[model samples]
Target: MLSVQLFHNFNKYARITEADFGLIEQVLSKKFVKKRRTLLSEGDKSRYIYFVEKGALRSFTVDKDGVEHVIQLAIEEHWIADLYSFVTKAAGNINIEAIEDSEVWLLPHHELELLYEQIPALERYFRQLFQRAYVSLQQRLNLTVSSNAEDRYRQLLQDFPQIAARIPLIYIASFLGITPESLSRIRKQLFQ
Candidate 1:
């Protein structure tokens, strides 16, 4: 059942044969994370890349003031990992936590390398995925630097309407680089 989302995502990039899917399944392990559980913590090495099959997860960092800044949110069918740590096996700066009780498929680095070696197409598939991720990150950074908090909030709503309904306002505010009170004000102004 979890493979359904994985297969659907992979199909967008490459034709995944049933045999390919079976081989891919062999390398994946399923894990359930409870809400608010930390899957990866700051200064810990990220050994696995997670694919969300159900529920939500987020990556964030706390500032010196101890304020949390959300970096990314991954819901169903999305992938989340500290890419630098995953690639270099270094301690990560971000923390990944489950925002809700979740089911995830984990692909270990070693198993991923083996799959890449055995199935060359898998390498290309991941490269495309990374390229897209890079572009999205760049676009997000652009928005963060150029847009006002209210505009950013609007874009967030336009992009992920489901998020507002599912996630708390505090988290959404942090993701927008605004205070929760500011978000409340903005929503009031927009709605009223």
Candidate 2:
């Protein structure tokens, strides 16, 4: 059975009538991922977009130095994907993995294309998702370039309040482009 939350999320972007939504429910498959399991590895073809049904997942990249940079943290109701690879049919540089045991709904790209034509409203939902993802990318770029580490950390807390407690501190530090020790100091300063 499909989740009501997913249905609500879909309707949030575009209306899907009861009958039309059944078309969607038919195509999405569910997968349960264990903690630390990789969903999409770097250099793999991005074949699917996942909607988090329960628990957490993260998308990140490993640098030449072997340092990981967290790109996005996805929790319940969040959609995670390497859109660039998905759209271009190119190999993806991003890696996605479960941070905790998780249940996710998968929407395969090939199926999505057929759904777009069959359910025109689905296109608008995906379009808004991509637009939001792009805006988030642009905003993060602007914030990273113009802000200090402390400011960046502060903004992160403000934007994703659940992240600090739900995700590991190390990943948060990586996302902020700072050492874990630096994050500890920032937390101390903010709290005390």
Candidate 3:
């Protein structure tokens, strides 16, 4: 079931042999998470980088006041992880949770290191993936700093087309760094 997409995703970054891909398939484990499931809780050292195959997930942090500030959102075909914890083996500050019932492909970081040596192309593929993730994070930070709330909201919709419909507005407000009431106002204004 996950065959074509996984293989296609790897080949999109680098030409991979079937034998090499078979190794990757062996290490990957799939699971279905119900909505609101927490894949990685805050303070946990992450062992896997999850690839969303069906639904959506988000990474966020809760403030002292119990309010969540979303850091990243990953939809189908996208990857999500607490990179710092995954790479350094330290506890992570952010929590990764499912927004919808999601089918995810879990790629173990421990196996990935071995895969890199066995298949040189895999290293290139992962390197490219990390670079792109970094670039996206930087761009989001830049947008948050430079753009107004409405512009940020608009950008979110443009970046993730189904976000406004599939994701809760409160999560959207948190992602945009705005209050729920303010987001409601913005939506009202946008339609007028």
TM-score, model 2 to reference: 0.97
Best by lDDT: 2
10 residues in a row with least lDDT, candidate 1:
1-10
lDDT (tens digit, per residue) of candidate 2 on 1-192:
689999999999999887888998888999999999999999999989999989999999999999899999999999999888988889999999999999999999999999999999999999998999899989989988999989999998999898777999999898888999999999999999
- TM-score rank order: 2, 1, 3
Residue 170 Cα positional deviation in candidate 3, in Å, after optimal superposition:
1.0
Please, what are the lDDT tens digits per residue for candidate 3 over residues 1-192?
A: 355777888888998898898888899999899999999999999999998888989999999999899988888778899999999989999899999999999999999999999999999988999999899889989998999999988888787878678888998899889999999999999889
Question: Per-prediction TM-score, please?
Answer: 0.95, 0.97, 0.94
The CA lDDT at 1 in model 1 is 41
What local lDDT score does residue 138 receive in model 2, on the 0 to 100 scale?
95
Error at 185, model 1, angstroms: 1.1
